[model samples]
Target: MPVHRSGSGTTRRSRLAALGTLLAALSLLLTLPGAATAADSPTAAAKKPARGSATMGMGVIAHDGRGGLPGGTLVAQTEGVDVSSHQGNVNWATLWNSGVRWAYTKATEGTYYTNPYFAQQYNGSYNVGMIRGAYHFATPDTTSGATQANYFVDHGGGWSKDGKTLPGVLDIEWNPYGAQCYGKTQAGMVSWIRDFVNTYKARTGRDAVIYTATSWWTTCTGNNAGFGTTNPLWVARYDTTVGTLPAGWGYYTMWQYTSSGPYVGDHNHFNGALDRVQALANG
Candidate 1:
């Protein structure tokens, strides 16, 4: 009886010690920073963008939590559009007929993916008498900004003194395939962008336009205003108004106001009139 009682006591003590350890672990876990919330979780999965697949405004239109009014209609500026591989060979004549005076076509992404339809879209838009530029869908995670910029320059992203070609654009926004901001800290993102911009200016003799959403700019770059003086801002907002711009930008050079055009791609507006579009192209 004595031995049995001793065994029972030992078993109870062992359970109590285990329980104490579990409680201590639970306490530590509760106190730890960055416990996963739904907000921190990867976005409810959509069709993740494949390599060479991401286009202009893909992330902003897909995962930008802010809801833009559906079937949105607002008109009052110089009309424009952006295209990529997704649009295939765009009907530039049709877009021209619809009054789109300026356009941007996706040129390269990271250092690997160049838009297969680039030649058609880039040349087609310019041939149709539209002021067109090429944009790089930046993948800072895949390569350094300078490497991607070099790839972009070698591809269709190069600028010329021609009156029809606008400077290239850097489309930096949410990551469709992974974490927001491509997992970079604000300082790191700013550095990556700096490398691309400096390299692009060296190669092309023009500062690249920066395309982004205000929400993305705040979250990724901590609303860094450093680029405002150098890069033209192509602010994307699919609402009735352009809404608030990111810090440092006194005005948006272009506004991607909606993706609900009657034709193929998203519609945009130059901040000024048709002559102003020519001015940008001239520079």
Candidate 2:
């Protein structure tokens, strides 16, 4: 844009005054409390996801809530719940009394975050006589799956065959923090997941459970079916039915039925009875 510059005194003075006023306004904006600066710009803010701030099934309700309430018979299904730092310290007694027989707590996210409330949520569930496990929120963009798995294990994603501790879960769903598939292609996503689950198994001598929503799985791995054999599936669908699962899994080991389920956190159901939950824990 070309500006017409005049040699006339009045025009020059007017231009100088206008420039001074603009600078003063900018200075005022900078001094204002809570004002947005370059560092707080929307574009700058979107680049970084808070480390260690995610939980299990974080994206399910938002992405796949179209399932429309849980449907079918829950008769023999075991009741469970999954919690994260968002739930803070859980009241396990309330959950247990509500017939929640199993539970999972967020253990770690990528290699950067470990749940601060892990001990309380994990141990409290066990002490209350509920079979419990831990889950790792996968951030495939930040680190290799193996590194994350080790971090998860080091933090809290360990297993014990005490008939009370279920295997850790790998939460590889919609990336709430960044790219939909962590900016990876379907094949790349699969390999990353493979690395994480493999490393988790190698470190703990137990297969890691994989938690995901069907839509994300389909979009991310093109609905890859390779993991159904070794890892147990924990499918999330916030509706009346469990709905369609990802390509590889024949059955879901656990179903996260509703984020609005009774009691605390997101409620879930083991595919079978209490003994089945115990069996997974024992393994």
Candidate 3:
């Protein structure tokens, strides 16, 4: 499950499913009247802070060209632009004041396409964002995973940086324009995913972070031990309310719980604050 354009050309279905699950559960609890107390609320349950936790880092995918909230910093990565040039004008001071902790500049695309200027721009921009970062491709075609990894390493510089990055993310989702990726049988999809993850780890010497939907996880990689145990999961479940994702999978490191936020330029763009992400990362 690699990140792909949704039919609506916005947030991924995995994000929608996560949000749907939370809303459904919250609706059920509300209907029950005495389902849970404030201390036991689902929102509270999903947001309980981790012990000895660090401040949460907010993230924003600055793909579409648009300015968001001036404060509450965003992590914007360009596919082919020199991201460094925009560093000085990125309003980092405002974001820091508003509570932003990290930013992941895009480094590469499909195996053959590299963000030509990421290297020149993101080499050491950590001081601008609380945490600096880099990311790679997550294609549905496992055969291409190795190629994508190699490209990311060769082009994105192997996620090497002076600052601490939230694990390198493999954005697994739907690719509506291409073939039917989600149509693959759960086992087949899991196998493909495992191939990608294993290949990436072998090449990068770093654990790959999986970004996908809960349904994708259950239907595709739920039974695969490789996914269930080896890597961290960055789940996309966009709902009005937040809560723990359904069980059966391993630990999650981030949750993209919404698509409509001031920081998100598009109405359907993906957006999730840092508290949940930090919880997932540190959980």
Predicted structure with the largest lDDT when compared to the true one:
1
Runs with alpha carbons beyond 4 Å of true place in candidate 3: 1-90, 116-125, 161-163, 222-225, 242-250, 264-283
Model 2 residue 26 lDDT score:
94
Q: What's every prediction's RMSD, in angstroms?
A: 8.4, 7.1, 21.5
TM-score of 3: 0.54
| Decreasing TM-score order of the candidates | 2, 1, 3
Can you write out model 2's per-residue Cα lDDT over 51-159, one digit (the tens) per residue?
6776676677556653555666677898899999999999999988888988999988877778888899999999999998999889999999999999999998998
Would you list the clashing residue pairs of candidate 2?
68-239, 68-240, 69-239, 69-240, 70-239, 70-240, 71-240, 71-241, 225-248
Which pairs clash (backbone N, Cα, C closer than 3 Å) in model 1?
A: none
lDDT values, one for every candidate: 0.88, 0.87, 0.48
Q: Write the per-residue lDDT of candidate 1 for residues 1-283, one digit (tens) a residue.
A: 9999999999999999999999999888866897665556765454476677887777777865334543455444688999988889899999999898999999998998888898999999999999999999999998999999999999989998888899999999988778888989999999999999999999999999999999999999999999999999999888767889999999999988777676988888888888888888889
Position 245, candidate 3: lDDT? 49
Worst 10 residues of 2 by lDDT: 1-10
> Residue 20 deviation, candidate 1, in Å?
46
lDDT of 3 at 3: 45
